[model samples]
Target: MAENKTQATGASVDEFLAAVEDSVRHRDGLRLLALMREITGKEPEMWGPTIVGFGRYHYKYESGREGDAAAVGFSPRKASLSLYGLMYGPEAAELLPRLGKHKTGAGCLYVNRLEDVDQAVLAELIKAGYRHVTTALHSP
Candidate 1:
């Protein structure tokens, strides 16, 4: 809706991170960057004004809307971090207990701090999201 004007996009990751602007949120962004890099070994790209995404995917809806989206991503919102998990699905349900303190939305995981959750569990969840989406991508 009104999200496109957030001024969060730029030619480079440094520029995008600079636009993010919240000090605490910035630290969490850096940590997330490192973890996503460690797991996916890909650099972050700004999906929108606030979303820092890694990897990519293409999807076609039953309604015939097709689009490309990040396979895994996250955003540092004012109140919490919204991780783009593409739907936690069956496997992800198992990791929630070990994920520490967090809340869930359709395709997002809301967390207050990186320290508030288990880093290993966070990594596992990200990996699961990637695998889950990638599997769907190849299915008939």
Candidate 2:
């Protein structure tokens, strides 16, 4: 199988955040760093060039495709903050209603601005994603 392009890197998370050109997004990135760190009890790391991820989990499919991925992560993209892992969890639909303004794809949650969402609910959403992946891995 082809390698995952978005592999975890030894890149500096702080340096990456500082390099973000959008001042608002930069600030939001810092907040998310702290929030995810607290929620996962893991320091943030650069996943590829842009994603700031906390913790990791390995996944294997029936086809024998397997890889490690961040348990939860986000990217402060130019258009919006892209949250990963949220929609992968079953609890997402419940927490999303409380997340305030946001858009959702199959595995991502996009928010135009941090202020447009409830920070507390966002934290809970991240926690749910982490738990879902971690617990699923442990279950039969």
TM-score of each: 0.84, 0.94
Candidate 1 pairs with clashing backbones: none
- Candidate 1 lDDT, 31-139, residue by residue in tens: 8888887887777888766688877776776767666677788888889988986345466878887788998877688999889998887888888888777666742
Please write out the lDDT profile of model 2 over residues 37-138, one tens digit for every residue: 999898988899999988888888898888888889999999999999877778888889989999988678999999999988888898889898878764
Local distance difference test scores for all models: 0.76, 0.88
Best by lDDT: 2
What is the Cα-based lDDT of residue 23 in candidate 1? 91
Candidate 2's TM-score: 0.94
> Which 10-residue window of candidate 2 scores lowest in summed lDDT?
131-140
Off by over 4 Å in 1: 1-10, 138-140
Clashes of 1: 0
| lDDT score of residue 121 within candidate 2 | 86
lDDT, candidate 2, at 95: 88
Worst 10 residues of 1 by lDDT: 1-10
